[model samples]
Every structure is written in structure tokens, then in C-alpha cells.
Target: MDMLDFGSPRQTYDIRVEYSLLYECALGIGAFTWDEVHDKLDIGQAQVLQIKRQMSEALRREVSLAGLHHTWRSVLFLIHRCPYLPSTTQEKHLPVFMDWLKEIKDSIRTEAAPYLGASYQAPLAAALAGNALDMQKLLDEHHENPVIYQNLQYLFAVSAEQLLDHIKRLVEGWYEEVVSRDRNVVATLEQSAAQTSALSQNVSHEKLIHTVTRGGEFVAEPGVTTLWLIPQVSYRPFTIRNHLPGYAVYYYPVDPDAQTGLDKNRLISNIAAKHKAVGDVLRVRLLELLAASSRSLAELAQAIGASKPSTHHHLLLLRTAGLVHVDGGVYGLNVDEVLALGEELCRLLKLDGVKAAQETSQGR
Candidate 1:
């Protein structure tokens, strides 16, 4: 695959930051160690074929390049481990766990050990118990191995690089099938490609990439360092690389100031401004403590390293901004609003009971 380097730092940071949002959502909701949510994820043999058909059929209809890019990445993501797709609606359109349930056990072992507790395993087992073949087919078709983590009642595994390749092929097969069946979809896609590409030498110094390709195509690549590529040369980057069937190359950086055409600072400034209301060091610490769980006003103040009266004053402000709310003598973040933010907050903040208890004692 031709590695075109788009030399821009601010742009790259922008892309990574937005991508982080998706990852955050996946980590938060998808990783919920609860039992009820885990029980419904059953990918029977027929369902697996359906997933293949939906994607294959979509391709036959001239899949939107943007949709295809995200879909391909989603396939890669599922293969890695089923990720929890966050949604605000009451009902989920797709099973959050899917075939990825088996990988959850390893993720727990590796990434979430301390905070996850043992509550997650039972639900996880419930989710994966019936789907015996989805992940196996995913791994085998992709030519990768699921790392042998300890066996829970369920088998969880993922293949990193190869899975990505698998997604690429699926996209290609769909497109080929579509071109044979429907001429319009392919023609419309060609005319509306996301970016125009030509051999351009002018690029920023930082936005450089090295890779190999056949007549300009991104081959199956295993990221940058872990595996080395030969015949490496530099070029410009494009989404759904030129003439390379199914190879969608996302630029590492998105323009921070311009997403389609908007200022990043403008988008985030108001949020930063709200920090002032609950943004004070003491207020933040105290609010964070309450957010972790319900606590007495006195408890929060101690956690904030302040006297009860001072902390109480700050909590009042947080409540005003709709960041926190008080019930009787206890304080807490509005759980409804917090949950509405999707599962991303699980990492953005941690719930700490010790801080609250300490603060409570201090207030006493």
C-alpha cells in the first residue's frame, strides 16, 4: 500500500482526539460488568450469516465511502473484541457484545482488573455461552490467533492486524458483488470519492508515512513498528486509497480547528467556561468525589480539602450549573445526565469512595 504522509501536526491531533471519543464510548458502555446487559448477546450460526449478508448486501448497493470506512473499522473493532456501542435510545439496535464476548475476559485481565471487580464475569459468560463459532470464523478467516488468556466459562479472543485485513476483504467482496449486480452504485461512488489524490510531493514534514503497495494499493499492514515493510516510500494519504479496492486509509490527524469547517476552541470553550462554575480546584475535587457516589456535603468538602461551609458553597454552584444535585444532606452528580453522556465517563473520571469517606469524617 502506498503510504502518503500528510504533514500536519495540529490536524493529526484533531483526528486522534475525535477517534478517542469512539474508543471511550466503547470502553465505557461495552465494558459494563453488569449481568442483565450480558445475557442477550447470542450470535447463532444463522445470525453470523446475516451479519455477513448485511455487509455484503450493503456493498452491492454502493456503500457510502464514509459508511464503508466506519463499517470496516467496526468489523476490525469487533474482531479485536466486541466493543460496546453506546446509544442514548432505550433499545439497542445491535447487540453490544456480539461475538466479542470471549475477548472481554482477557480485557478484564489485562486492562480492567482492579476496578472491574468480579461482577463482570458472570454476565460475560452468559453473553458468549451460545455463540460457539462467530469469533472462531472471524479469527480463522483473518488468519490470526486469539491470545490464550485463562479460560473462563466463555472463550474470548481477538486478532489485531489480520482482522483489519479481513475487514478490507469483506469491503472489497461487497463492492465486487455490487458492481456485478448494480452499475449505478459503483459509478456514483467513483464520482463522489471523499478525497482527490495525485502524486503530490508537497507535504508537511511531520505528516509523513512509509509503506509498500502494488500499482498504488495499501496491502495488509501491521501498523508501523512491530512489523517492518520493504520497498517503503513516502506519498500522500487518502481515505479509500486511489484505485486500491477496499483499502480505506484514514489520515492520522484531523484538522483541529476545522472539522468539515468549525473551530475546535469554539466547540470546547463553553465546556471549559462551565469549569469555572464547578471548575475551582476545591469545587472540582469535591464534585468529582460526589460524582463517584453519593456523599454528605461535609464528606465532599473534606475531599476537596476545604471546610464544610466553603465546600457547601461550591457544591451549591455545581448544582446550579446542572453538574451536580443535592438530596437531603447528600450530594451527587445527576445520574440521569451522567448516564446520558454514554459510557465514556468511566475513564474520564473514577469513582473514589475513600475520598468521600475521608471528607465525611473531616466534615464531622
Candidate 2:
């Protein structure tokens, strides 16, 4: 994999920022913790708790019926497959999204499965369960299993409208309350987009990525052509990265002017947090355990032979330091953040022995 260096031939990347209510709703209703949201955004504790409650109730009533994973899978599919047409009203995007789902269902039903093997449906089902967004690729990769096909077909029929309506309600009801008041969400995004566009025009892809990704990273490899810089209000202080075969998206946190006070001290504080997080023996062991596979809090505690509260304390520190992430109630290490910490340390110390000394002297 080739790293995109700061000095390179002008390879232009289309950088744009947009607000998605459905995307926010999807993430809000998914595996993310409300604590994470509160940690990053300027939202009140009571409001955060209320939003969490609303999300829980909505998921239980609507999304859970279709299986939360399946619903999220659909959400990802919608994001990746559906063309986000330019519109002032966010709800206008829903019809196109629904149409895409309908098309996928229609193709699977009418069009014969492409594979000739014993069971394409099994592979297809596994792919769907695995959150494979591409319908054709799912068909091509695995022999069709009737069970898988039927389950998906049923899911589409039963849950598609429910999922859309659920998103619609959340967007209208919850997202509005959280973001609509005095929040120039679109203006913030437009500013970010314009700034990004100008920066990209002048800077290399590598520098552009480093600036926007915060503590996170963007890997540019062969066939990874396009990059999306989407700003969101819900998932704050953390940039969620998603990659398909051809493209990748970085859902950046929308930090308003008031919350941007930490900019001057964020790097130093983050470095301190990272070092402190890894300085613990328990946290190191926890990372070792999570390296293999994601685990629940109970499993982590049991593996570490520590009490749940004790284990959670260490995990909280790691999470606060951006060394770990929770997905679907399971904790996983942010390998990129881990690697970036090492790079940051090296950048601080490894450049020159004399330079480090000179910086210390200059500070004095």
C-alpha cells in the first residue's frame, strides 16, 4: 500500500461536507454510547439522556423488530448505494433511498442468481449479515441459499418501510430538537467544505487527510480513489471511518465555535491521554484481548480477572484517549489511533536529538 505523501503530483480529491439526518439517526440508534456523544458535543446531560431514551424506544419499537444489525446493514447500504441528490429538505433523500432498496429487492427476485453452485443464498446471506452493501457482489461471491434469499426478501418486505419511517421520525423529532435551535448546521458544513476544497487545491492528499482526520487516519491505497468528508453533530470528537471497495468516508464531528476552544491544547492533551492510557498494565492486557476480536465488558472483565467496575474504569480511560471504541455493546481497539500515537511520539522525539534539546532550551 502506497502512502500519499505531502509532496506529490497534484492528484485532486473531491472533499465535501454535508449533513445527513438519517445518517445521524442511524449512528444514534446503533451501537454508539451516549457518553461518547456527550464527551464530544456541547449537548446537556439531560438532553443526551433524553435522546438516548428516545433512540432506545425507537429502536425497540421499530429497528429491533427487523433486527438492529439488519436495520444498520440497510442503513449502510443506503449510504453506499443510493445517490444523495442535492436537496434543501433532507426528507427528499428518503424516496431515492427507498427506490434503491426496491431496486435491489427487484433484482434479487426477478433476476436469476448469477452463480451456478449449490448455494449462492448462503454466501449471499452471510454477505448481508456481514454488512455487504453491494447486492451484485453478494450474488457473485456466494452461491445463493434459499434461506438467505428468503430472509432478505422478507426483511425487505417487512422492515424496509418501518426502517424508513423510523429514520423519518427520528430525523423530524429528535434530530430537529438537538440541532435545529440556533444551530447553523448547514452553514458550518458549507464552511468546512469550502475550506476543505481550498486546502485540497493547495495541499497534497496526505496533508489534507491529516488535517481533517484529527487523531484518526485516512489510508490511500490502490483502487481507493474517492474520499468523502461528511460532518455530523451526533458522533462528536471522533471521526468514524467507513470503507467500501472503491471509496471511503470519514464522518467528521461537527465542533462548533464555542466547543473549538480545545483546538490549541487538544494535541497536547490527547498525547498525554494516549500515553496515560497505555501506561496501565490492565489496559495493555485489555488491548491484547481486544486485538483478537471484539468482546463485551463482562468478557473483558472475566479475561482480565478483574471486577466489572474496575475493568470499565480502565476501558473508560482508553476510550477517552481514543484508544478503544465500542460497537454493538462490544469493545474493540482503534488500531489506527494506536498506530497514530506511536507516530506522534516519534514525530515529537525522533526528528532530531538536537532539535528536541533546542526546543526545550527555547521554551526555557
Candidate 3:
């Protein structure tokens, strides 16, 4: 067997920022969590609980029936491939999105096939055919140790048509019950998209991704022709990454204050926050440890000789300052941001001075 090359030439791909209400809705649904990690979310536990309580029973039932509470990431596979006009209203696109899902139901399994291991062909074929016995046999053959197979068990058990219907209902219900009422969220998303799109035009792909994701790095991957940077609010402070056949999607968190109109004080405060985040000896040590390698919360806490809560607090500050990032339950230092701190500070200070001079001239 030949090993596949994962690298692609830089010129082969372009990055763009996109706005989609349906995509945001999908992400918002995924962000709903009841675990201890809910504290890490921008919405926080109280709001999440409120959102759950406010949901209609029918919508709640659909979400529960489809196991969306835990398996919501699966919906992104379909969302990434769905054909819809960019920045269109969700109401207009929901029906079209559902129709497209139904249309592709027969071949839906193929979208996920590439991500699975080489041994997945038999089970994937069985899944597509809705053959329970064959799927069981393949699962036994593989010993079912593959996490992807476990994650997608529901898809294998039902026909694509049935699975998509469940998805359609869950998404539509989420929109009607939760998304529709939050008109301000759509405006925020549009503003975020506009801000990011403008920045993308002015910056390199690397810089744009780092700035938007607050510390993410996007390495070129084979076969990906475009990188979609979709701004999202529901999962603020965390970025969700996904890949399709020809594109890479990053549903990155939007800066809440970016759309709130910038002022000199706000700019200065933002710069100060970054400095303040690194002002502590313990925090600096944490960064040193992360610089060496990615570490889990427990590992980081143990290494720094601090309680988990204290370490989590320090990490939260570092993360907010764009100096750290957690992926796959491990925290890694964003070395690029750390190295460019001086340059970033100077850039912001110069902009602040320019803005102040303009304000003085305008007599604001």
C-alpha cells in the first residue's frame, strides 16, 4: 500500500469568509452542552440551560430522538456539501437545504467515506444498503475499536433518507424554536462575516485564520481548493473545524465587540488584556510548558503545581489573549501569536494614535 501525501501547494487554494445562518444554527445546536466544560463556552451554563428549557417539547423530542445533543457534529458533513446561496436568509434556505439533503440521501454515505479507514469499505457499503447483518459482521471483523465507526453508528443503522429526515426535523425545529427568535444574532453574524471578509482581503491566509480563530493555524492539505472561514457566535471562544471533498471549513468564533463599533479606549483595553494575561509568573510557566507540547487540563495543572480550577482560570486568560488554544482536549501554545506580540502591540498603538488624532480634528 502506498502512503498518501497530505500536503498541497499554497497556490492551489484560496481562503474566504462566508456567512450562513443555517451554518450558524447547526453550530449553535452543537454548542449546547450540559457537561462541566460548558463553563468554557461563551454562552455559559445558565444560558444553555435556559435555551434548553425554552425549547418546545416537539423540538426537544426531535433533538433527543436524533441524538443531536451529543452527535450534532455529524450534521456539519451535510452542511458543508449543501448547495446554498452565501449570506442568504435562513428561512429561505432551510427548505432548499432540506431538499438538497433528501436529493443526496442515496450517496450521503460517500461524503463521510473518505474520513474512515481503508477497512471501512465493507461496512460503508453495508451502511448504504442498510444491511444490519453485514454491518454487524464488518463491525466484528474490525473489532469495532474505531471511534469513527462508533460515532456514526446511527447512520449505519438507518437508511440515509431516514437519517436525513431526522436531521431536517432537528435543524428546522431548532431554527423555528430558537434561531428565529434571535434576530440580533443574525445581524451579529452578518457583521462578523463582513469584518472577517474585509480582513481576509487585506491579510494572508495564515494571518486571517490566526486572527479569526484567535490562534489557529491552517496547514495546507491535499485536494482542498478553498478554505471557508465561517464566522459563528453560538460557539464563541471556540472554533470548529470540518472538511469536505474540496473545501476546509472553519466555523470560527466571532469577536463580540468587533461589531459594537471600535473606540480608542476599547482598542487600548484589548491591548492591555493581552499584556495582563501574560503578566503572571504561573501563567508564563504554563505557556512554557505548552510551548514544549500539547497538554490536557489535568496534565497542565499537575505540571504547574496548581489546582485544576486555578490552571483553568489562567488558561482562560491566555486563550482570551490569543496566546493559547485547545484542540482535541489538549492545550497548545500559539507560538505565532506569542512571537508577534511586539509587532501586534505597535500596530494597535499606532492605529489608536491615528484614531485619537482624527477624533481631535473632528471635535468628537
Candidate 4:
């Protein structure tokens, strides 16, 4: 029942680093907020607004008819197989990608048919619902959402294929115009990945992941065999995931403005949240109690000598700062993350490095 458990790691000889034009386009299309597009992206405000207008004009029919969620859902379904996607807009890979889409459609139908609604279109409907691409949840949702599953199948599927050429063009053009121009940013990302991997060769998998990714740690689950560490620019400071048993992909974001924005580092903001979480003596007592053993919210409230709502609010802050994690109904301390807070603070302040070397170091 654990959503994070996706079997064991698969044995792979090499760790790969690659950029995705598809990822950038997808984020621009639907995932990113207006503030993120204006501030986080390297594009100028006028240019960004122009592109948005063009994109809106181009996809107006689909957006109007099917809604933005369905329109973006089809886009993601086409491009979600990122590891297999070509690095550039090579026309040769287009067919290969389309064939993979058909296979995905087939897999959904076959795997989901038995549990899904009796209607023939049930699987395709669920696929088009455009939920985040968590495969485990995809399989489980027939039980969880039978009505939405059964009703919405054919609405988007009919138009999804027709919009393929337009989507392809949008992705390719955006890559050429916007993403490719940031060659130095891309190069720095590749170099950083190599250095992080080298540094982690002697370290534990979890610690290495934490050091490299800032917040996310690697999990050696039962069926996961390979991990792809892809670096993304538009989706800064979040470790996005597409998890599977043998193969998993984590999209770690890169700052668009590498010099100043990244130099100041957002981890300082997150670290401040961490400080605020434990700033109250009552919350500190709650963390201490949870460190010994996992406890329910009521139990934590009783131990902390605070009301349930107050204790729950304190726990929410800790959870937001990634200092605590919930498993089942039991709240447990994220012990390593809590411990690494000081180390993170030291790294942020440049106190962990040698004096001369410290000045030249980027935010950890």
C-alpha cells in the first residue's frame, strides 16, 4: 500500500544525464504558473507574453472543447516517455515515439479492462483524465473513481491524435527558439551532475541523493533497477518523479538565472521554514517525542501538553519543511533530514568548506 515502494533497483552500468525539450514545452504549456514563467524562465516578459498569446491562439479549439486539463493531458501522454525521447528535434524519432504511445494505450486497455467499468472505452477515458503520471495510481483508480473513469473516456481520445502534429511542432519550435539558446546553462547542468555523481561514489546512496538533490534521498526499493537523474530548468527546485519498479526518473530542477538567483539559493528559504517549524518550544518537544517512536496526532498532542489542533498545526509545518513524514496514519520524524538541517545551514553559510575554497563554492 506504500505509494513510494516501486519494487527493487534494477542493475544498470551507467548513470545518465540528459535534457528534455519535451519537459520544457510541457511545463510552459500548462504546468507552470504565470509568475514562474515570467520570473523563473529566461524569456523576457514581452516575449513570454507573445508566446503565450500564440500558444493560446493555436490551441484554442482544443482548450475550449475539451478543457485545459484534457489538452495538457494528451500533451503529457505523448511526451512522458522522456528517457526514450531523442535529445533534439530529430524527425526520425517521431514515429518511434508515436509507436510507444500506441503501446501505452494498449497497456492501459489490457491492464485496466477487468477492474474498470464494463464499457469498452473505459480505459482510454481514464488515461485521458490527465492525472499526474503515477502508474500505480493509474492501475488503482478504477476502484477509487469508477464514475469519472467510465464517463470521460472518449471525450479527449478522439481529438488527442488529431492534435499530435500541432503539439510536435510546438515542442520543436519552442526547443529551437528558447531552450537551445541556453547552451551554457545546459552545459553547467551536465557538469554539475558529473561532479555530484563522482562525489557520491564513496557515499551512501541516500546521503549522496540528499547532497546532490538538496531534499530528495534515494530509495533502494525492491524492484527498482535503474535511476535516471534528469536536470530541468523551468521546473526549478523540485524533484519531480515518474516511478516504476525497474526504471525510475527524477527531474531535479535547475535555476534559470544560474549566477544570482541560484547563488542566493532557495534552500535558504526552505531552511528558514525549517527553523520556524522548531522555533516554538512546544514543537521542539513534539519533535523530540516523535524521534523516539512514531505516534498519532492525539498521542503527540498529549505528550506535548498542547491541544490537538495546535499540535496538528505544528506537525503540518514540520511536514511542509520535510522534517517529518507520515506513514499510514502514524507521524514519524524524518530523522536524517532533521539532522541534516544543521549541515544544510552550514553548507548554505559556506562554513563547511575551506576558507579560500568557500568563496568560490556555489550553494550546496
TM-score of 2: 0.47
lDDT of each: 0.35, 0.58, 0.72, 0.55
What is the total number of backbone clashes in candidate 2?
9
Q: Identify the candidate with maximal TM-score.
A: 3
Evaluate residue 74 in candidate 2 and report its C-alpha lDDT on the 0 to 100 scale: 42
How many backbone clashes does every candidate have? Answer: 21, 9, 0, 12
Which of 1 and 3 is ahead in TM-score? 3
Candidate 4 per-residue C-alpha lDDT over 251-302 given as tens digits, one digit per residue, 9 for 90 to 100: 7666344445543445667578789888989888888998899999889989
Off by over 4 Å in 2: 1-17, 31-45, 53-60, 63-67, 87-91, 94-183, 258-364
Off by over 4 Å in 4: 1-14, 33-56, 59-67, 70-156, 181-183, 255-364
Report the C-alpha lDDT of model 2 over 1-364, residue by residue, as the tens digit. 9888788675555555555555665555443333445645544454354343324244445545334323443454355455544543665655565555556553432121222233445555454344455445653443265423433554434433454565445434434433343234445555666676677788767787787766565666555668877766556666777655456677776645634544325455657768998998999999999899999999999999999999999987787566777656688877767778877766655667767788999995
TM-score of every candidate: 0.24, 0.47, 0.60, 0.44
Worst 10 residues of 1 by lDDT: 227-236
**Better-scoring candidate (lDDT), 2 or 4:** 2
* Clashing pairs in model 3, backbone N/Cα/C closer than 3 A: none
**Residue 277 displacement in candidate 4 (angstroms):** 49
After superposition, candidate 1 runs with Cα above 4 Å error: 1-76, 79-154, 157-217, 220-251, 257-264, 267-272, 275-297, 301-364
Model 4 Cα shift for residue 30 (angstroms): 4.3
What count of clashes does model 3 give? 0
